[model samples]
Target chain A: MNVILSLIVSSVAVFGLVVIAFVGVWGAHLEWLFGVVIPYLAVITFFVGMIYRVVQWGKCAMPFRIPSTCGQQKTLPWLKRTYVDKLDNPVGTVAVVGRMILEVLCFRSLFRNTRLEFGNGQEIKYKSAKWLWFGSIVFHYTFLIVLLRHLRFFTEPMPFFVPIIEKVDGFFQLYVPTLYQSGLLLGAAATFLLLRRVIDGKMRYISLPADYFPLFLILGLATTGVLMRYVLKADVVSIKELTMGLVSFRPVVPEGISVLFYIHIFLVSVFFAYFPFSKLTHMAGVFLSPTRNVSNNSRIVRHINPWNYPVKVHTYAAYEDEFREKMIDAGLPVEKGAPEPAKPE
Target chain B: MYDGGKIIAGIIIGLALLTFPIWYTSGRAAPKPEVKLPVKEKECVQPGPYMKKKHMQVLDLWRDSVVRVQQRSYVAFNGKEYDMSLQNTCMSADCHAKKSEFCDRCHNYTGVVPYCWDCHIPPKEKPEEKH
Candidate 1:
């Protein structure tokens, strides 16, 4: 099955990464390559590839005002339309912006997700599927927090908000080093998402290796990060030194830093490199999606085809000039009496 | 590209946010924290590498042992038995007299606001004269 194949391939890929990092760092002493070079390369690839993809998507011309809407269209002034309808259909720029904000921030459309099922009496039914939305929002926000929390390592004198985020994240005080909930939640959410793809028959059928790869990769990334923080326990001081060095363009591989840290960052680097090429680019693509971003107001304003060429028209006067003689012979009225009886000339 | 202005603006904003650390720390010094290692004690409650990573966990274990279980003495890896008090053991005159010099160095550098000082009274330390 495709599901089994994807699971195997992605699992092996993550496994291969661990082996590579272990062998590279512990065996070959290529800490600089793993710590410094790869991170820089990954960031460069991420930015450049993302911009390229966005530019490619941007080049696509949407000649029609096709917005996927489920609400009423704006018509006669007397026809009543609710505020919800305006948001759902988005007849203006402001409404479209509001819709997009909700869609991006809260995943409004996914919250309205439904699963279709056939009943015993040949009836079709749609049921709310909020778990996917819940899992997705949790995964995204936690991942963002975890990412932002990492800023402590990259900045010196520490950004003012980093400590605030840290306090909130570690408020429970579960463990000695302060177990961050975001890291744990991110891993759990990724697992749930992966399991949903594997367990659901429809999802499994539609799921490709590309889809499974990211989930597995993310699981591996999160696992390594958690391991470094809790189990393996990488040196925090040394990590900050290395990360601060990296951002400031002066990299140094500090002593006593574990290979687990290398594995973690290597996984991160791979993720960064893979992001633009993978479905993960939906982060950027969401903004460019015509259906979500465009307002559904074609009736109000014309949208001319950008590629349309200028057309020359055969005017009535020109037609009459060419066929005036024929028209007079045919006893049809002429515009100028056959050109002032041209014989006078 | 279509909507070039909006798309480009979005990208610029994203890049600026992503690369904040780069521009924010440009021309600034980010020297790694240098803690003054205790010269008298050759070994800590545990090994150096272990302490570097999980010192908080070790301290927590010691605290729970002393307060909850009433186990006051700790057996180091080197088979040396010692009292389990933070003040008597860790901050003893020979081990680490100045918390600001030894403890605060790495803690502040890593942005770790450990609650160790909240309950345990830190020793009086003179502010390091600025260069």
Candidate 2:
């Protein structure tokens, strides 16, 4: 039932994403709404939702040490245990940060992943699978670069470095029309990653339709952009005017801008709006993950549970005094004076 | 174990590999032909009201005769005019439409800025008419 419910929810979400992409791309006539208003709403929702989620997580208590560890724990000076895991001192914390850098930048865990399967002759086999990791790294890094390059669009006085980046990106000299290295790389990497999920039985089994939907939507956007570049050329002057207007918050939808342009913009808009709600929310969730941002200073400082309660106390001495007569009757030693003459009742 | 399911899976994968290229190339089929004009004409004149009423007809004829002939020519966005045979138009927006060449020539010469390529197709000679 849980799986079925998740499938349904993921399907609905993906379907909604597709609709949003289409509307955004073809709906240039409604640029003010999608380009300006929707983007504004998405930004607000992203911040508010992220803050809400982070605050909620902060309110939850963690009374136990639950840091996911990779190396050995620090103990006994000569034992050679991993200082990063056990002591968690400042230097050790830097080691953790170093590990995170490789994980975030290169998808280190993914690189270490292996696939287990039954081979010929009923033999069990484990095989290293690093293609997924490679594709993902390429996709993310190229995406970051492409996004940074787009900063040229938002700023008035173009930064000094943008031209240098543009020249470097077009260094391939692939055709009479200079080709953008990252653009092609981004598309190829995205395709490879998507194919891994669809073509690999194991990945497919674990994937919800939501996983496939974002991949497909992004693929659509990439394909359409390539088409605009290499095939059905559209008006550019009008496009820049429109884009400039949007960034300046004085949007004016140009008359001749093609529907394809709208489609590209729309897909991007959908990506932004759906970003905070979907698994893609990892963009924000990464900052909120307790494992990454929380300090690992368990040794230097104490974390007292604020919810601890006060209770009545009893000591061993009190117990002994209370049972002094009982102990003597039971042939046990007594702490105070022993037997005496019978006194008036 | 020579399991039947495993064999079937392998066969299915093999079949998919065979058909993948076909699907990819089919998507790359040429776009519909755009309206063109004659090579002899230096400037494309706006048509009269009567001729404008039949714009589609004029466009069809112009696309066949003029655009098909001069389609091989290329233009650049940089402030230098290079023959189409020497340089292929890849990223420039100046030569996107029929009137775009004039814009490209001037903009390329003057270094005037324009953002015509971001959303539009880069200009190219008609592939089918190459021969």
Candidate 3:
């Protein structure tokens, strides 16, 4: 039920965004608002919101020096250290950072994650969930590549790497308009992620509206973009003019840009606006996560909370005085030798 | 309990900053890009709006034809034939006497850095007429 609600709510929201783009831009002809103003608004919201959230997270203090250790820690000189897993000091800090880089770049934790299921209807079995990891990485890397490709449209004379990447992306040159590998991979990866969420009962149970929203939004954005490129073509120079105007701080809506293009941009704008508030912020938040970022060496080095406050305590003598009779009756050790157990409250 | 006040303040400030562009440009409308053309055209390969919207695409086609495929002439969208030569076509053929005022104005306004100017020599500026 929760899964269905999540999917429905997210679907409704994405559909609503599409409607606004279609009706508001195409029907009402508010080209400037949809094309320029909304995009700028989305950008501002994205940056400012992202910074605020990150800074707020930074202000949070972790009282415990806890790092989620998965392997053997460094101990005596003879002990073999699972260096990256059980991070300790400065060297261990570096190892943890390296691990973090791997985590951020390849999603190492998700790669190592396992799923539990019934093997013989009696015992449970753990199996590698590598495909989820693969899907996630493929989605992210392809998304990055596609974004880089868009820089070609935004920039003039095109950046050096843009054309190089474009050449590589369209290397096959199989057909007109030239298909990019990343665009296809992104769509495939997003589909896999959505399907995994829907098909896996445990995953569906754990998933929320936040999780489904981005997937739906991205799929819609990708669909519209693909449609613009292949099915109903848009004017390239007009798009460049619009994008160039935006980058130059002088946004102008060129005449004759298609409704599909408007839909694509508005969907992107909505995604941007939604990003900072949602779990999509894991892109930034993952770095600030205490479990992944901190180093653990509690035994080797004293760990103290800077914000810890003093608490009033009852002394052992006071406790014994209060419970001496009870202690004697229960055969528990008494501070004063036994027979004084005759005290009445 | 969490520091709700601080978080709220941060959000408010973030919102303020996000809407900063709208704040400064309040009550003012966005201006459309303007392109100036020669008074009497001998013949344009395509319509004005077509040129404005897809000159780069036209250039791309021209580049592929002249540089890569070694073609000389091509037909444009409006059924008019244009010489595939960049210097002869864009620079000389009564397109724009001085590129600084015509091509460069819009290009610079849009912050587009056209690569044609990289290899090709730009036309000399038209001398101002004194009364």
DockQ of each: 0.75, 0.03, 0.13
Candidate 1: residue pairs that collide: none
User: In candidate 1, what are the lDDT values of residues B1-131, reduced to their tens digit?
Assistant: 99999989999998999899889888464788788888988999888888888888889999999999999989998999999998888998888888888888888888888878778897766676211
Best DockQ among the predictions, by candidate number: 1
lDDT of 1 by residue, A214-316 (tens): 8888898898888888887888888888888888888888887889999889999999999899999998998887888999878888899988888999998
Instruction: Write the residue-wise lDDT of candidate 3 on A197-249 in tens digits.
Output: 99988788888888898999999999998887655666765786787677667
What would the TM-scores of all predictions be? 0.94, 0.62, 0.69
Q: Across residues A1-345, which tens digit of lDDT does each residue of candidate 2 receive?
A: 233464466556655655664565565356566656665676556556654554455566666445555555554577675544442322255666665565566676688778887999989999998887889889988887776565444443444566667667777645423467888999999888877766777676787767866776677667777766545655544565565555555656766666777667766766666665678867645534456434555764687766678868887778787887889889987666665769989
Query: lDDT per prediction?
Result: 0.88, 0.56, 0.76
> What DockQ does model 3 achieve?
0.13
Candidate numbers, best lDDT first, in rank order:
1, 3, 2
Candidate 2 lDDT over B19-93, as tens digits, reads: 332333333322112323334432222323322223223333433444567653323233443333211232233
True contacts kept of each: 0.79, 0.00, 0.03
Fnat of model 1, as a fraction: 0.79
Off by over 4 Å in 1: A118-123, A315-317, A327-337, A342-345, B27-29, B126-131
